[model samples]
Target: MSRRRPRASFAIGTVKVRAGHAREVGLPITRLVTGADVSLPVHVVHGRDDGPTVWINAAIHGDEVIGVEVIRRVLTKVSPKTIRGTLLAVPIVNVLGFMNGDRYLPDRRDLNRSFPGSARGSLAGRIANLLMTEVVAKCEVGIDMHTGSDRRSNLPQIRCDVDDPHTLDLARAFGAPVIFHAKLRDGSLRYAARERGARVLLFEGGEAWRFDEWAIEAGVRGVLRVLAHLGMIEPVEDEPPPLSLICRRSGWVRARRTGILQMEANLGQVVTDDERLGGLSDSFGRRLRLVRANRAGVVIGRTEAPLVNRGDALIHIAEIEQENETPGQAELAEPSE
Candidate 1:
């Protein structure tokens, strides 16, 4: 007869959640200007059986709030009672920046770049340290959710170390429209988690500060799919998952002449080299320059802001083979500058 593994308790900060239950705990951050203590809220769901522990975190960049809605919807569909593992969900990580609708901490430091930080460091660093110690250290897998920066929109995509077999499998199971071979950025949460022996998948979709229904729905579905792949939940057979287009490299098309930018390309559009993507025109309706594709690729991201300056990134394209590239064997590209 097979033996069942013993159920374990999940603890973070001062709260402890045992098997087959869910709990919400607040991890203290620094105080505000008004001396009010701010805390990072976490929802933990611990299943009755033993399985892989996973964490889903959102709002590392406070302005990219679509992930918050995605996490909420995902939690609504998940319960600890019938699952086989623990799920840690943190809908808001940067409380200070989230409250102000800003992208960076009050100290102007980017929280994403302050990972595995020190307790005696800056505000962002301290928060990073807290998350690494209290949340990330306890998980074997993680999914960090994000949307594009302000004035930009991204197609639903999974970005991860595609060369790693296990990480690549999770990325494929996520079923995003695109799978990007994104390398770890210095000091980023993915990098830190990987250093601590955890495999992480970064999900990028929609735009900052606003919830896009398609992106949110895709994200919710993808998280559930990953959980199912991890044996934490039953498979969701809603629809056949989309085939992920793998991209080795991506480049940004920048505006040549500063003017009112009119983009002709959109997310998910395929373009060839020298294809006209847009035209820049002045306020008087005189065309200054025409933007063309520098390489053959599909549009994965684009700027929404009509007004642009010289060298401003106007479109993002991911380079993929028209044919012959197999899944899990695609080449990787260098991290974007």
Candidate 2:
């Protein structure tokens, strides 16, 4: 009987580390619809030795620019020579949206919702199709980065379905505080990735079209921790921040009446029942509505749009069982790295 060598799943192609041409390790899926020949940038790292493969991506929503910065730092700092198995990093997915500084593509389609994509569909759908077919179908794991839209800010969090133990493992390993354990939306990248037999963790932080230093630091460190956990690199201490607990349920506290808005509770602030989140007022300074937390939990997301309709979501809250789970005095010895 002849013995055969085990195949490396990420060894789909060789990465080009040359000048001008950037890198094109993976096979070309499709040329983007730009007037110029400039296409999406993809860097595939298939290490000489076999290990796990994790693809980290950012800017699915073009307005969410912090992840783009995060991926840039991660790619530049993570030497492929030191990487073990493989790391496929795509800093920007929605090129058109990013260029226009809009949340959706020119076609008004959300790329995140258009995935696992269609080759013969709209522009965003085509890009989604490319990612689903070419990149995601070949990866073992993934990390999709995101942020809150408009003036609303998100304290760094991992949002995913916690029903599966394996998915939970990856989420924990990713090491972001405050997880929103919720059901997967139909067309989200998480559902698409899961359909492709890979578990992906979505990191939500900061605000769209803005930069938050702490959120960016949390994102970059979380990616590094995930990479370390996947055995792509040796484990290194990150001086982990306060690891907020998992939140199983969340919803929005809508504006009770229409008027000018002033927010009280901030992102990541735990709110007890009946606590005021914010208050709405008329142009004449008369109070219109007082936003209150219906349940006790942390504020995961909110809307920054000052003008609001009666039913518009103003404050998004996540209900958690462990409201008091922050790192204690004994655990805060100069913040271990």
Candidate 3:
């Protein structure tokens, strides 16, 4: 005789998902000018066994599509009948911005910067509040997926509070190329979730508005590893990723002059202090200046835009440290928001 107790239905808004089943719940947002209703689509996978609930969200900045793919692939591997915990997969967060291929909302507010918001606030704030109340508040862990924005590309890396023992362990299981010890920003989703007692891992990879196969693979593998670590699923079949490097501090190297750029330093390459990273030239083929690193570190991000203005960030470097050594002071500049 089966000894399983009667499973309760998981409710989100008005939608209830029976235990060991999955449901797509559309939480009403608002109505369009054309009288069409806009809703936040949430994929709730309520597992058979009891365990921790986790959320994986992507496309907070609509142009960052890599995370959307990562969530989709992850959902395919996890089944409601076999898993131990609930997985709230929100594949798209900025639906309005996503529809228009933009990064911000219609009112030009960054959705990421509006968090733990009020119900009667602006559109971005309301949306953030909705997500916080409907999904993140119920979870113990969250993974907010992202990529380099404003025409920049990033190496696959995990950003979290490396000082926290538990979060650090989760980051290690994520198996990104690097684990950046990042501090929380004022209005970020990670910050809001942290305030609500939820641990978060921010995954950065690829460039905006395009799909990167390597980044997608890393994200899929990392999410699976995290799930396994949490005992929500069985062990992953693939070989584990290589050991991740730890970053104590990171900063961006800015352009010296306004011109067309040709980057010489590739992503993931180690460079010495003040080493040449790229060159700049005028439209008339006259050499302008050579861009150099600000410190000894690994190249984690680079600009994809050819034409840049003076003081524009051309490359991002993370000062790496061994796991045994103590983490250094805060970053010269935060690499990501």
Candidate 4:
């Protein structure tokens, strides 16, 4: 019979982040600087354990930085002594955009749009290739954190192709009150990973270039809970998780007429097609162009900026049937992680 390989272990300063020492460990992925063998800023935190090797990566779009911060806090408090398998936390995947405070690479290409990446292509494509090979290829489970575009904010939510059995369990274990289960897009990180037989989850919240404490806390705690479900972490006694609503359908509410927008509802609130979500006005607020939802559902996400144009995406909403029921609302407990 074949034997399993031994697990590797390590420590980080005062924190004991082990891969199998006890449970999981977080490792720092040292990066090499551009045009030199020297390294740039990049890191990972690995937990020690015999469980699954799960990777949580964030900041694919430099301006969408909440995940970077969220991963940082998760590392500070994750006790390597408690992890059962492995946890790899990568906070900044897009170094160039992160450093320059731009959403796209210097080539002006959306990094997230390039997946499985090009081994020989533009800077963004190259980076994507490196991650697919070195980081994601090694992981059994992955979570890519994100936020809405610079113009919008997203409520705390978990999105995945939940039709998959394993993914459905994860979306539930995440415990967010809102869930969007759908298909994968071409060339997305989720698509590439699934092709490799790894199930991944995408956590969306807040807006690009801005931070939401509530959303961050929700994300950190949700990830920990998922670890528990995967046998990678100890199960701690906790309050009942928020009841989740599955929105099998979601779409953008475009601007019918170009004008400045003033939103009436915040992210997470429910909306209908007949009701006014927000309205548009001339630069002087004289003539108004109203915006409305195309279907009935929750306002899981929306734009943050006031500027708008006809057909410009204003809100990214998630919905079920017009009469589909949802759980009663109870304020989510404060994030403990």
Candidate 5:
């Protein structure tokens, strides 16, 4: 007879979860004006065997709801008994903003800009502090999910500090259509998590406040790939993943003139420098300005709204190496609205 290995116990906030089981834990934030308590809900899956602990959190920005579904699907596919390490998933991190359907808290502060927060500070600060202490501190690796802000939509992409070998490995393992070297902004969760000795990957996909099936599927698969790369669970597929285009630099092309903008290129499309990307024209079809690509690159993000103002960002392009050129089918035939 084989001897059974001892199971581990994982605790967060006031909740405790034993190995081979799952539990929902709530980290209290603050009460609403109506006297209702708002808490950050976290789902924990502790594996029987010890390995690397990974934390996957979504909706740090409340309006980015696609990650909520991504997290849900990931949880449904993951079983605690088969995993080797703990999985801490917080689908909704900003409960106040999530409830209000706003990007920022009622106090009008961006939670992503208030990381490593103070306990006695503003609302965003307090929530950030709580997450840093309770969730991020306990994990070895983290995935922060996000979507394009305002009226913009993104091609499913992975953004991380590729300079870090460990983070770069996870980014490539994620198998997104593209991977860009994104610098960390001060006070952002990625920055805070890195400072705490955890490698982090930031995934940007689809648009805010709506679900994109393609983006959601990509997100779920990418996360599972990372987990398998960490030996937390079995791989979803035995075959090698499709190659991901890696870009070291990217920039946005803003509307040169305010008008009704018409795009000639779609997201994930590759264009050469000086190629016509779009045109801004008046309602009567009088061309006001012809938008051209400033440099040769792949379109990773673009605004969905037809109406535009001068200086408004219209297309985001990332410069990739020749060897990492994207396949023709990787480009979308139509823009995602």
Candidate 6:
């Protein structure tokens, strides 16, 4: 018979978190202009029993704040004594951008695209390297939280490689409304982590800089359910998770005219091809054009901005396959990672 490996304290940086306990540790990032140090704060929960280690992170985009709250609430519910494995919670990864309410770092680089970075690289790259070396490298699974950029909003959804059987099972356990089979982008954290042999789930919902209550609630529930599925914690007593809508293809509908957009399509609402989604009009109230769906799918994301330029994405629709439907060839929508 195979023997179980001996358990030990979880060592992160210089802090050794003892088993059956939790601690908040800080990993130094840089020194501000005023000489004050900025560090990435992490909450480490080392469970009593042995199991797979998982890391949950938020604010990768800085402005996507909903996951911050989700992590906080999840921490409140999980005790090191009860959990079966280690849980690493990072509430804010882009501390510089988060402090300034900016999506990109002070160097104007998207942190999400600077993964597996060199220690001597740019600010974004260095931060990415710190996370990869100190946090991601220690985990078997990672949950990356995000939201729609700028004025866009997303329905609660899980973006991942659903073709992988283990990953697909975890996505379903997450209980999001939609499970999107998204391809990994180059230099993205998901791509980098996968390269290191870790399963990753990217959660997208709400919008930047605001707390959408529904999205926050769903996010909390989904994280807990994933923990349960991993056998790290006991199952939560929420409603049975949805028979998630599996989506393989998605496309964006753009505005044909530069004008004020009045949208009728709601997030998570299903629309048929050629259905009138809303209309566009000029400043004088003259109708310029009408926005319509090009395919039948669920409305997964949409622009909340009233003013839009020509060719700006107005609505995002995902072609879905139900649990009982036969899988078919389809393409996913192109959007920022």
What does candidate 1's lDDT look like per residue over 12-97, in tens digits? 89887989999999899877679998998999999998899999999999898989999999898889898888999999999989
* Candidate 3: worst-modelled 10 consecutive residues by lDDT: 324-333
TM-scores of all candidate predictions against the true structure: 0.93, 0.86, 0.93, 0.84, 0.96, 0.93
CA lDDT of every candidate:
0.88, 0.75, 0.88, 0.73, 0.89, 0.90
lDDT of 6: 0.90
lDDT of 2 by residue, 272-301 (tens): 888987899999999987889988777777
In candidate 4, residue 220 scores what lDDT? 83
Q: lDDT tens string, model 4, 12-91?
A: 32344335233232322334455433112334445444678788989888898889888888776666566666666768
Worst 10 residues of 5 by lDDT: 326-335
Best by TM-score: 5
Per residue, candidate 3 scores C-alpha lDDT tens digits across 171-257 of 989888789999899889999999999999999988898888878888998999999999999978667545677998999999889
Instruction: Report the C-alpha lDDT of model 6 over 244-284, residue by residue, as the tens digit.
Output: 78999999999999999988888877788999999999999
For each candidate in turn, give its C-alpha RMSD to the true structure in angstroms: 4.6, 4.9, 4.4, 5.0, 1.7, 4.6
Tell me the spans in candidate 3 whose CA falls farther than 4 Å from its real position. 323-337
Model 6 spans with C-alpha error above 4 angstroms: 1-6, 323-337
Q: Give me the runs in candidate 5 sitting further than 4 Å from their true place.
A: 325-337
TM-score-wise, the better of 3 and 4 is 3
Query: How far in Å is the alpha carbon of 208 misplaced in model 4?
Result: 0.6
Once fitted onto the true fold, the runs of candidate 2 whose alpha carbons sit more than 4 angstroms away are 1-34, 238-242, 327-337
